[model samples]
Target chain A: MEDDYYSIDSILSENQKIQCTFKVDIPDMGHLDGGHERDIKAQSKIQLPLWLAFILIYSDYVDFAVPTPFSSRVRNALNAEAKSVRLSALVGAGGHWYGFGKIIMRLLDDAQANEMSDLLTKTFRDRLAEVIDQAQHFAALGPAGGGGQSGDSALAFREGLEVTERELFSLAQESAKKTKQWYESTDRLRR
Target chain B: MALPVSLRNSITPPELELVASEELVEIIPLISIERTAFISGAYGPLRPPNKAKLPLWIAMNLKMKKKCHIVPPDWLSVDFLQNRLAQETSRPEFSEFPFRFAEIAKLLLDVASDDIQNSDKVRSLLKDIREARQAKSRDGLQKIDHSELGLPNLCSMEINEIRPFFVRAMGVLTHLTRDPEASSRRLDV
Candidate 1:
């Protein structure tokens, strides 16, 4: 099952164990505090192997969802490497690593930013089902059955379903609005 | 007489209407349709299970049932059953569970051999369990544990840096779902 889902073999086949060097442009951290600026400047050039890059990307998702002490170690390792390299050197060594990492990271960031949109889509799907289900349930009760007053009861049930449906629809719409907001924000970030 | 005429006109008897009884029966179909739709609709996207690895699949279902409280005492037994099967198949055995599949299978085979009359029933039950297990293996494969599966340490990255990678992974998932060809292939499986 894991093999089917991950296509680990395919990933391995595509894996390129190429040595890559890249210069990271470290913006002048004059605005930052003394130690922080120095730290940022020193760790400007980023160099990592392809395998490490994959691990880093995979770890990002895992860490985002569940923060653990182990995640901190990985984060520190990446940061420590980044901090150690000079910014000018990072910019100088442009290789597959830098290009590939940038593209993948950017795509990932876009998806993460649009999480609310995904949530909205899910909510919309759920609400649509809920509304239709409630409507049918009420209709099922019918106009007559319960103690000869089933007509009244059915009518009441229908009204209740209608109210609930309306509420769900409204909630879905709100979700949609939030999704739109997220989409716009993500679009800006991507740009 | 003129004064009493106004009061008499105001007083009227209530009317009762008899509704058709057949209309009541319509409720059953309505409820059925509603229930079906409700269930179908509840599943956001349906992915079919793979047919291969029938034994392992059964083990997973047994595991799921154990988790969901559908089968209580059987959870441990199911875990043992899975280990035994894994060992029998020479598959990569799960590290966590204590009992191996071979042991459980041997025990079951021995019990069935002892009770010749119930052997068929045992075989039949075993088959059913295997089918159930296979049903969920595909989904289980797709399921990713965000914490444990990936790189060792990720928590220390800044939120700004982390957000992008997370989005990318989700984008990949979304793309996988949206691809009609891939989805159809999965469904066919």
Candidate 2:
């Protein structure tokens, strides 16, 4: 998913860090962990950007932990009520939860990858209705509403949207606006 | 890879209106005019007091110039719209309607209200019909699946309204479900 050379989101998602441990000793790279040591020992863990981790993990030089965003607790909460889960909170700022999930699933083996992918798809399917509803709601309110029309719950839901969902929200919003503008801009016939 | 933003994905409502304008409409010309040709094809010989068939744009132009009285389409009347509004509200599925009804309705009601009987009532009924249909479409969107959604009677405007959402949501679904093992196998092969 991060493979698109021209996509900004793809590049940004590739830069997200994941936890991994070196499988074999590597020389003179200890400062990567923000330490003054001269070498990285085998089995020591540190966060690595996904782009580099992709190579090392696939080549059997590093092993990654399941990132917290896709951990069972978050998965359970999503399963319980997907629309209320603050997906952004699970992943933190500047990280796209869906985007990172795809890369992580790729890094895992067949069974685990399948489980995570299924979770991802189901979560999106459940929450998509809410996202579209909010987009259309905001579009109807127009910018002049300053987004206060839907009140606190909607604002909270909006703030919790990950970057991918945010993009989808705006696309839906712009489309709604275009339809409304077309409706109102017609020339009235003079009597 | 490179395309203008305005022309991407789905058609805009204004563009839909342009398409709707090509639909032929009935008009009673108030003055005589010779048969004329335009790029979209020929129309005219519009004579006084007798009805003529012209493209909606031509009818609108003549109407705006006080050269004709645009005849509102049958569906633009209060009774017809009331019936549709009843169907729209009573049924879960979208009521069958003209593919470009919203665009055409706007064109007629905006400029030719005088020619339409019970114009205000007609306007309100159109609004009721639109609102009823919009709610149904929103409900349909909520029920959307990754594989497909059966929304058979959706009009051009309704479809356009939901296009961005449907496209983006499907994009996410694809991203989530794309096979990773096969891809990695191919990549590291």
Candidate 3:
């Protein structure tokens, strides 16, 4: 369920508004407002989904500001958390942790990156440590059982689970691996 | 005493409810035909050596007819499942795995046990984990607090199997969170 929630969160988060400025001049780009059509004029600005923004930005077709969630406000808050509670709260609040991390990591991998890149790296490291710690606590529980029901009662109710939290754990590992790969590739490029 | 209201209400969204429903299965169909008509669309009278991608249901049907060989997913292998079981048993944290892994393995074990090299090992390992989780659930019912409901082994376990445990856990979570006096009484005990 956490996996589904995050997966949905990631998809929804991609649609969050981001400010973008066009560099090239092209005609008939959709209408942005009542009178003004989206002309691909130099220095033209607009708001678009982060997904589209990433593609356009990567292609050098446009430039954009990092959204508020990935800004210092978030980093500062994350830095303040003594445990994973805040990070879990962020996920619980319908935030896409991995999707956001991937975007920031990609930003860090950019050659002409700024101070925000370093901030992202630190935020991710701290957040990940917290997540791992939280997972470790859950891990300590062994598996679901031994509370109210016991012995024969437990065996009587075995039909296999419909969905498991395993996918959530798997997704976390996947995001970690991707982040690691992004770091390694960037390091390789730098050398 | 209890999980916060925000945490308790984070139930499964309908969109992700069918994670394993449409898993594509590879099959080498023995019979050759142009196409078969279904409500959605038409599919090929697939031929041998030319593998067809069909839904698990369709593949199962074809497998039943002896018309095709259902190629099992990579993770369904005996070695991998055994290794996964070992890792899950020994490690505190669960590693990444395919969604519906347990269900898929169970299906494979039922339909094509011979295909797997260590079928016996896989079967026993799964059984052991199942029994352990069931026992844990029985104990979990006694302890109502969220902290006492540790299910690390059930981390990646299938949901339906643990439904009763969660039902009880949720009831306890709701009861304790809504009523501080109840939690205080439990703590006092």
The models' CA-based lDDT, in order, is 0.29, 0.83, 0.49
**By DockQ thresholds, what CAPRI class is model 3?**
incorrect
lDDT of 2 by residue, B69-167 (tens): 998888888888888888888878888888998888888888887888998898788778888887777777666656666788888988888887787
TM-score of every model? 0.19, 0.90, 0.37
Report the TM-score of candidate 2, chain A only. Answer: 0.91
Kindly state the number of residue pairs that clash in model 2: 2
lDDT of candidate 1 over B1-189, digit per residue (tens): 665531332211110001110011000010111111232132112112211111222222322333111111132243444554454345332223222322233222332233223444544444444433322221232343233233222111111222322333233334222233443464354
Off by over 4 Å in 3: A1-191, B1-21, B35-45, B129-157, B178-189
Sort candidate 1 into its docking category.
incorrect
Counted clashes in each candidate structure: 34, 2, 27
Candidate 3 per-residue lDDT, tens place, B63-173, comes to 666677777777766677667667656654544466566555555565656556677787787666554444444444334343344444353333443443344334323
lDDT by residue for model 3 (A1-191), tens? 11144556456646556678888875777464234666557787777777787778777888777666556666666567522223333432345443454454443333423344445334443333323333333443345623443334222211110112223333333333332232123211211
True contacts kept of 3: 0.00
User: Could you arrange the candidates by TM-score from highest to lowest?
Assistant: 2, 3, 1
Shift in Å, residue A26, candidate 1? 19
Between candidates 1 and 2, the DockQ winner: 2
lDDT of 2 by residue, A1-191 (tens): 34688988888878888889999999998887899988999999889999999999988999989988888888899999998898888775565888889988787778898998889888887877788888888888866765545678778888888888888788888888888888777576343
* Model 1 alpha-carbon drift over 4 Å, by segment: A1-103, A106-191, B1-102, B107-112, B115-117, B142-145, B148-189
